[model samples]
Target: MSDTNENKLYGLVVEFGDSNALVKAAERVRDSGYTHTDAHAPFPVHGLTEALGIRRTILPWIVLGGGLTGCIGGFMLQYWVSVSAYPLNVGGRPLNSWPSFIPVAFECTILLAGLSAMIGMIALNGLPRPHHPVFNAPNFERASGNGFFLVVEADDPQFDLQSTRALLDDLGGAAVSEVYDD
Candidate 1:
């Protein structure tokens, strides 16, 4: 309990043998009211999200707003330039040619939506995070291979070192360890 970063507590990590164990542990953690818990597995584990109780993200709404803005802005830019800024009537065709603007507007909609999705996803996920305390967990690299792990962050209100460790130990996990910020 020295005033140093190395001694800073990050969380408790537990390794499960398989996806089923991981999912069940997540459910138990959620039911026990541990808000800052996370689970990791080598591959996509079905029912993990439901067990974690993670709510849907609002990124789709953000992307939709971007697309709509792009569409309207693209079409308006063309309309203003062609009809008001410098009207050019050629061969009895109206200066305000709406049909010709469709392609560009459609492209803008797609472009903005794609950009929004990419940027929003990255920003929302807290990207560019080169380091995390979970990486300090024992055998954590196996998370991408054969590991299924659960992490209960120390910042959670219900996270007591001894009790959390005991809870994980009692969950039939293969191993349990502490994670440090250093």
Candidate 2:
């Protein structure tokens, strides 16, 4: 590929067999002044987030927005139905009864929050993509089995190809591959 293509390609990929090795590699990558790096493992590895310096996700904020929207929607729907649309006066109760609306409001709140969480996660993570350059790495298929992989993207301001490779090498990585984009 051309240099432009290579520049668009980010990160070095290092494969490992165990989570311990992956964690150590992550720490080394972080210490190497790389800011755009990721780790993948077949299973959840405790403390991996902290090692990667990953912060708590913003999903909660999205859910909160959804919940607020749902609250307003549910209240409006109920108001229109019971008062403006139908004007039912049952058992001398007020047409816009707040107590009776609680159940529907609560349910709508949860439903919208859940929907927002799913959509937010997918959008934030750029899900449903058909391809990724990392898939081109040899032996990367093992990532879904027992292998762990760490990728430090080249877009990081501190990334220098040779120096990054040497850093990974010194960290005991068995192999490091440059990722490319088309």
Candidate 3:
């Protein structure tokens, strides 16, 4: 490919008539050892993630870390205020009482975990992305409504425009189009 054409190249997009075709195409692409591929559908299609060979996300770990930090911080804050900062004696109760810290600790843990999950998901997804290169392809607007789509990025080592288009066509893609860079 010429440098100018290569620069204009974004990827190849394959359109499927339904969820079954989308899943089958994804599986074929995965089995062909194409890693840099994505599938989109109007609704959740069973087994699509596995078909695409998508791995587990680290968002859970992020949330767990956030929760742990919140739990520890909450307990320490209470301890500092009651025992060291103020040292108030309430009804002959000990200043460093452990039971009184449970409620605040629990709330802090939940709050931090939930926030971390939302933020982590958005960050991982590269959200606030008003546009993507795939949107340049014809009929891409149907992806969110009735169409199922599979995209193979140009950066994939196995990608060759002619061969990739042929492969998609062979895999029952009704319409295949070249995606362009934004």
| Best model per lDDT | 1
**Candidate 1 clashes between residue pairs 3 or more apart in a chain or in different chains:** none
TM-score of 2: 0.91
Better of 1 and 2 by lDDT: 1
Off by over 4 Å in 1: 1-5
Off by over 4 Å in 2: 1-8
lDDT tens per residue, model 2, 1-182: 43664356657888877898889888877876777888888888997887787889999999999999888888889989999999988999999898899889888888999999999999988988879878766687888888888888888888889898888877766688877775
| lDDT for each candidate structure | 0.90, 0.83, 0.89
TM-score of each: 0.92, 0.91, 0.94
Q: For candidate 3, which ten residues in a row score worst on lDDT? A: 1-10
Q: In model 1, where is the ten-residue run with the lowest total lDDT?
A: 1-10
Q: For residues 1-182, could you state the per-residue lDDT of candidate 3 as single tens digits?
A: 32455557888888888999889889999998999999878898999999999999999999999999899999999999999999998999999999999999999999999999999999999997988888887888999989999999999999998888888889887778877785
Q: List the residue pairs that clash in candidate 2.
A: 10-154, 11-152, 11-153, 11-154
Q: What CA root-mean-square deviation does each model show from the true structure?
A: 2.1, 2.1, 2.2
- Relative to the unseen true structure, what is the Cα RMSD of model 2? 2.1
Query: Which scores higher on TM-score, 1 or 2?
Result: 1
Cα lDDT tens digits, model 1, 139-181, are 9999999999999999999999999998899899977888788
For candidate 3, the lDDT comes to 0.89
How does model 2 fare in lDDT?
A: 0.83
